[model samples]
Target chain A: MAVATQDTAIRTGRFARALIYLVLLLFVLFYMLPLYVMLVNSVKPLSEITGGGMMALPQVWTLEPWAKAWSTAQIGVQPTGLRPYFWNSISMVVPAVAISTVLGALNGYVLTKWRFRGDTILFGLMLFACFIPFQIVLIPMAAVLGFLGLSGSTAGLVLVHVVYGVGFSTLYFRNYYAVFPTELVRAAQIDGAGFFQIFWRILVPSSGPIAVVCIIWQFTNIWNDFLFGASFASGDGAPMTVALNNLVQSSTGVKEYNVHFAGAILAALPTLLVYIVAGRYFVRGLMAGSVKG
Target chain B: MAANATPDFRTRLQTWLPKLVLSPSLAMVLVFVYGFIGFTVYVSFTNSRILPFVGPDGQPTHDLIGFTNYAKLFSLSHWEISLTNMAIFAGLYIVICTLIGLILAILLDQKIRGEGFLRPLYLYPMALSFIVTGTAWKWFLDPGIGLENIMQTWGWESFSFDWIKNRDFAIYTIVLAAVWQTSGFVMAMFLAGLRGIDNEILKAAQMDGASNWNLYRRIIIPQLRPAFLSAFVILAHLAIKTFDLVIAMTGGGPGRATELPATFMYSYTFSRNQMGIGASSAVIMLMTIAAIMIPYLYAELREKK
Candidate 1:
């Protein structure tokens, strides 16, 4: 009886495992379907795509759309080419991300190290700031920027993003610093280190996970930003999304389906490249929350 | 775990100076974040339009019209449609995303294989801006050139999946993409919550001969309330302000079918040059968001306390 029961349990386990794996496999397939379609259609000739099914693999894989997407489709008649826009995005985003992260780190450092008067009240104010959306600020900011001589410029956009980005970044770094032990700071202090020195040397060493979160979050936020890039910064300084918007909206008469997809691929390249290179770190960072220690 | 043992005001002050050094961030938060909204409220009531009609000395643009724009906002036909669509979109997006996230999180917690790869795959959509995702979705949904066309070519000429162009069902497409984009964060949050649960409780449940479903229903779901609330709040917030996806996917087209308040505000403010009308619309939307969010935020604070 014991032998029979053992055999039955083993068989049941195998069966359940098989079923679970099958379900997971299907789920994976479901998740990848759109990406798969994008890739397959991207490679296929325009005629073939318009003539064929999206799910089917490309019979004659061509790099034509990618080439077109990267080069000509990027420039168009608008004269705002991909390279310049790419530069604009990078320039604006790098500073925005860096400034926000630096301030966040400093804020985190101060919040953690300092037991100050009105510190918790300040922290509460920061929390309150996060709940309010930026849409309300759009008109006021535009007017302010225009009045302050920052209208239709990259600097204006940077300020806008920084204003928006600070709330989340501070929360992230503050919560992260909260999880780190005060003993570390105390030890650094016992060794006669000042606040800046301690943060630069001691606190930063263990900030790998949190920094990755900051970089990824900041990168994604600034890169994919449509509203800010559209409103504050446009013309030659327009980011890829602006180009994308123009591209999709510009095609006259019968729509150029291939070109639209191509433009989109160009616009999406930055974040996609980030994921490809630092995907693991990105997920791990987010999953780990803002804390590193 | 470490707390200051002594009440040393000098040491505290010494430590506190670093925080003061970081006050510039607070300045930005104060002026742009809090103050800008105050400015928005002031503008919403006034008769500001296009350039905001500032005085010659650059003194102020507070030409108060006493809610004329607000009155005009309610009399419009699309306002009702926009509100209804926003309510529906918020409801559907939150419910669907939360449900999928919870299920995915639970499934992941079952010790499934290939979790590392699969987890990121689920999350990749979140990293890309909605512009990219929306662009991809549009291509996939376009009637003549996308999935439906492809579907028809494959020996089903009569088969139709034409929701993308239909004014009525186009909003659902936005929901689908939004869900795809946000579900991963939900899953991760729930996964964190699940990991926080005591393993002993699960073992005890198993010892008591509880079924898998029973264990999840009674033991797991109860513990995941915090994660659920977090997911729900985030989704609800995103839903009310969903602009990029609608703009990229459908452009609030097919006669304003996919129009939410954000898109509506963008069109009126930027495209049509009616800053007063747009600002008024946005102000109302802000109030609505605040109405939902303040209670939720208070409840969350209470729970945290």
Candidate 2:
């Protein structure tokens, strides 16, 4: 009986180990396959790419496509090219995230520590704000943008993204604050620390995780944003997203796969770099944003 | 602390200062977000065409034609197709991403070397723009100059994968791209949940000689419900609102087979200049999300212990 039981135990251990390996191998393939295909095809000459299998290594790799994508695809001869839009994306997103996150911190501070008149109602309304789809606001937003003389500026796009972006950011900050012991706030108040004082000195400093979360969420939402960018900006004020559309979709022209791949790669570089550098914090940020809510 | 204490003027002002700081965000919430939604719903009821007109012109203008715009919306084949496409995309996207995410999460949850690197590989897709990702997918999925040609050259005479052009299967390509981009994030949710599970419970089950399947089915799955719920809700919301994936991958192409509500509204408002119809569609989209969400929220909130 002892011998049989020991044998079965050994078998189960081997099976479990094998199963784990198989699952991991399959998942990695699933995750990496498309990316591998993209990278392999991007470097290969059209002949090699089309004539060879997607999984095959590039036989005759060339850098010409990347150069063409940068110099010609959306980078026009007229000077106002992808560079302007690249800057536009950077300027709009950075400031929008900054402004929205700061305000979100303030809202979270107020909601958690300072109980004001109709405070619960205010919090409810803020919660309600997050759920509403932004499409409902396009016409009115256009009208408002027009009225404010912001219809064709990068700043206008920033303003709108911040407005929409704040809801989620606030939810992040507020929910994080909820996890923090209320005694911290009560103790701070007892120590004669005011709202802004306590928030800036104590809460904000310790809120590194939530802050990272806010930055990543806001950055992605704003940078990858197409609808708001398209609606708000055109010409020089356009972001990378709009430029990408123009580069990929020329209504009356032949499609350029080489340039399109180049543009696509160029477009994804920023967020990808951010992910590589600060991915763990970003995950923590998302977890806090999602799980609590 | 005195009940109903009449606070001093300085205390009152100091207390109100944070609210003052909050005014900027409040202003945004009031005018930009909610205001536009209200205005769009109003526009939907009007007889507006081409562009949004506030009042009647000698030509057809934005007049209060009641349910006429909605009447016309239901009659359009384009509208029906777009709605059908959205439903299909959302359903497939939510289900596939969750299933893949969960399966991957479980594998990574096991004690394994190199699991850390794999976690980032899965999550990296979440960081990319759909437009960029879409471009990559298109090239890889292209017939002559991409995967298919490459495959043909490798001596596989019968290897055809061209869903990008096939109207029926075009949207599935979009779903595949999206799942690639988003499943990793859901996997992170499950990873975090798995980390939080008490190790002692697993050891106790092991002592009881419980099989792995029994341990997972009876103990672990139930413990991970919150994590699953959160991941599912976020993924479901994203799927319903998917427009970037479609535009980036197929552009609702091969005959508008991949049209989503957001993209459809965009075309109506900008391309077709049918603001009335566009506004009407936006209202419907908003209401549909709200309808689905409120019930989910109620159920979850009520169930909270």
Candidate 3:
């Protein structure tokens, strides 16, 4: 009777494990479904998608949609496609990410290593900047950008992102450097190393991990940003997201679902690439940003 | 005398260098974030319309009208709809995301095979821009060419999933997409929390002959409070700031069914020529977010101290 009871217990455990795996597999499918649809539909001719074959793999795969989305698709009365806007996004994101990460690293260094009076209050002030809804500052920002002669320009968008992004970058580095041994900094100081020298030589070499975290975080954010891009820049200078939105939402002509999917993929590709390459750092940045650790 | 003077000057420079390095960011934050916030708050109480009334001296002409925009905004039916939609959306989005996230986390925490493969697949959505996710989901949920069509084609002829086009249910579709996007990140958070739990405690509980259900209910879930709180705060804030997804999916359509505060603020300030009213709405959104964030930040920061 004891032997039989053990056998039944083992059987039930196996059943539970199978159930767990099945549920997990279902969720995986659920998550991948949108992506699968986007990819499958983007390549098929417009006929296949409209013919109720969205779920079925295409009988004839073509890259015409991609080619059209890249160079000749209509985006708000302009046939320039998403290519220029893709470059616009690159220019904007590169400068914004670089500037913000450097500033954040410096700010984090000072806040942690060069602690002073009311520093916590100052850090708190910067940290809170990260969370405020951008709507509160829209009107003023528009006016300011106009005054600075930057309205409707990529540079204007870059400045706006940098200003906002510094808060997050600072948080990333401060948390990272907080646990960094201060003794090294002190020793460098004792050995007659100057401020910039100590930072460059002693601290920066070991800051690779946190720097990757900050850069990836900022890169994804500035690249994916639509609000600032839509609000601050327009015309030929609009970023990839804004341009993509225009392409997809433009009401004139037939609803080219294929081109829309291709355009959406083009917009998503850069950040998605960053994420795929550096996902571990990306997750660390997400946790660090959200959980305040 | 020269040596003494040089050393003193260097000391002073070193003392000031860090502040100098920090000053540019501080100045930018001050002028851009705080100063701009102050400017918006002032505008909310003014008679400023499409163009802010700038004086001849190149300053904002503050024709101070106290709370008039606030009154007008609160009285508008459109604003009321937006607020009501926000309440429903944020509530449902938060609750559903948390539940789904917790379940996924718990399931993944069981020593499963292919853990690495499943985790990244779950989280890839977070990497995509909301606009991208919005585009994908917009089509996937469309009735004519999407799920309903596919279902009907697959011989489920009675299937109907038109929530994206329905007036009352359009907002729920936003909630669905949002939960899809961020729930994975929440699961990661909870998994991190679970992994941090001491295994010896689990061993001790098992030694007491506790059932698996009781073990999770009484011990494991209780220790996940921090993860739960973080997920709630993050989701609440994300729900409030939801604009891109709504725009991409519905455009606040079916006659303004999904007009979130973010979208409302955009249309009023940028489109409807109601700067004062728009600023008022924005202030309220900020206040709502602050109510959630301030205490959380205070606790998190103070605990660190």
Top candidate, metric lDDT: 3
What lDDT score is found at residue B99 in candidate 2? 81
Best by TM-score: 3
Superposed by TM-score, candidate 1 places the C-alpha of residue B146 at a distance from the truth, in angstroms, of 1.7
lDDT of 1 by residue, A104-189 (tens): 88887787676576776676566566656557888888889988898877788788788777766776777678778899889988
Model 1 over residues B1-305: C-alpha lDDT tens digits? 13454546546766566866778988888888778878777777877667746778876655788879889988888877888888888888898888887887676666666776677777787777787778778878888777778778877788787788998899899988888888877777777677777777777777888877788899879988877777776777778778888988888977989888998888888888878888888788778778766666556444533
Off by over 4 Å in 1: A1-16, A74-76, A79-81, A190-192, A284-293, B1-16, B55-62, B292-305
Error of 2 at A38 (Å): 3.6
Task: Spell out the clash pairs found in candidate 2.
Answer: A52-B150, A53-B150, A136-B37, A137-B36
- List, residue by residue over A1-293, the lDDT tens digit for candidate 2: 00010111111466887888887778778777766766666676655554454577767788776766665554433424355667779989889999998888888877776756776556555656666666778777887787688997987988888888887788778777866777987798899988778888789888987888889878977888887777778776788988887777765455556556666777777887888888876666666555654
lDDT of 3 by residue, A128-239 (tens): 8999999999999999888889999888998999999999999999998999999999998999999999989988899999999899989998888889988889888899
In Å, residue B196's CA in model 3 sits off its true spot by 1.0
User: Which is the leading candidate under DockQ?
Assistant: 3
